[model samples]
Target: MEDAEIIRLVLAGHHEQYAGLVQRYQEPLILFLRRILNSEEDSFDCAQEAFLAAYRNLNRYSKEYPFRAWLYAIARNKALDLMRKRHREVLSIPDETMVDQRPNPEEVVLAKEETALLSEVLHELPEQYGQALYLRYRQELSYKEIAMVLQVPVSSVKTYIHRGKEKLRQILERREIRGGKGQPIMEEIISR
Candidate 1:
């Protein structure tokens, strides 16, 4: 079912319909939170809080924006709040345990190596650029959706993404020259 129709049904007193939205977005939302929080438990908690907040504020949700973007904006706000309360910076890392379900052991090792390298490179970037790149490439959000989530203009989103990619490419190139065995993988990533 369409998100709009589900939302309409939910607002019209069929509160159970909200579960469908939750089911649809829960995993991706939690993954997004995890990247920001860097703690599995905290990410799950934040995801729940964000979902609750979204539900309560459903009436104020504008239809002009994509529902996924709106939900991500809520999630991002929740993550920022949690970080403020903790009074510390969160170091984002990809979960090592999360690997492709393919049975090949070699593929799993390559996946882990790639994830580690990407995370290390992202950490070196300015925080905002790292986040912009993550949202654009990792989450596959539209530029407009990323702008909404970041509370920035679409033009800013475009600039951030472009600059971020340029910076990432430079970092990868340096790694390729310094690292022998990882050169091919780094070059492939840079080519992408």
Candidate 2:
């Protein structure tokens, strides 16, 4: 079922139906939070809190907006709140790789290594740039959706995404030059 339908069911007094929304977004929400907190426990807690907040504020959810974007906005706020309380800069990509279910051994290892390098480069970017890249590419959110989540204007979201991609390109070029490596890992990372 669609999020709108699930939400309508919840708002119509089928409180148990809210679980559908939770199950739908649980993994991505937790993974996003984990990137911010770098702790599985903390990420889970934040995701839980975000879901609760969403439930409590369900009535305020506008049907005009995409449910996933709205949920991500809540999750982002919850993560920022937790970070403020903890006062830490421990954000790093979790050790998760998007490998195929059935993969060649050598290809899997290379993918893992490349992913690790890409993660480091991403984290090294300025927060806004990194976040823009993550939300735009990794999460596959549209500009309008990202604007909603980031509480920014659509123009700003576009600018951020463009700059983020350019910044990533520059970083990769610098690395390639410094390493003097013939590998096109940078292109692979960006093209992927």
Candidate 3:
């Protein structure tokens, strides 16, 4: 069923139907929060709180906005609240170590290393830039949906993504130059 229809059912007092929404979004929501919070436990906690908040505020939900975007907005707020409490600024990428299902060990190792490098590079970016890039590329959220989640203008979202990609390219170039010499990317970034 469509999200709107499920929402209508939920609002019509079929509370058990709410589990479907949770199941559909649970993994994505947790992954999104994990990028921001950099802690699996915290992301899970924040996602749970966001869902509860969303349920309580379901009456305020409008059909005009996409349900995923709305849920992400709530999740973002919850993450921000947790950040304020913990005072953390560093963000990390999604964990990609689950390679047991893949066929080749060599490919899995290479992919894990690449993911680790990308995560390190992403951690060096400004929070907004990293988040905008993640939402656009990793989460596959549309520009408008990202704007809704970030509570920014769509133009700002576009600028962020463009600049983020440019910065990422530059970082990769620097890594390519210095990486062969055993210099850590963090040292390279810090020296600049």
List TM-score per model, in order: 0.91, 0.88, 0.89
Please give the range of 10 consecutive residues that has the lowest summed lDDT in model 2. 177-186
- On lDDT, the stronger of 1 and 3 is 3
Per-residue lDDT of 123 in model 2: 80
Residue ranges of candidate 1 with Cα displaced over 4 Å: 96-99, 177-192
lDDT of 1 by residue, 1-192 (tens): 999999999899999999999999998888788778898899899999988999999999999998899999999999999899999778586664474687888877777877787778888888778888888767889989999999999999888877777887888677664354644544443455
Ranking by TM-score: 1, 3, 2
Arranged by lDDT with the best first, the candidates are 3, 1, 2
Q: Residues 1-192, candidate 3, lDDT per residue (tens digit)?
A: 999988899999998888999999999899999898888999999999999999999989998889999999999999998899888775898765562478878767766776677688888788899898888767889999999999999999988887887787678777674344333432333343
- Candidate with the greatest TM-score versus the true structure: 1
Clashing pairs in 3: none
Q: Give per-residue lDDT, candidate 1, residue 40.
A: 87
TM-score of 3: 0.89
TM-score of 1: 0.91
Cα displacement (angstroms), candidate 3, residue 16, comes to 0.9
lDDT of 2 at 145: 88
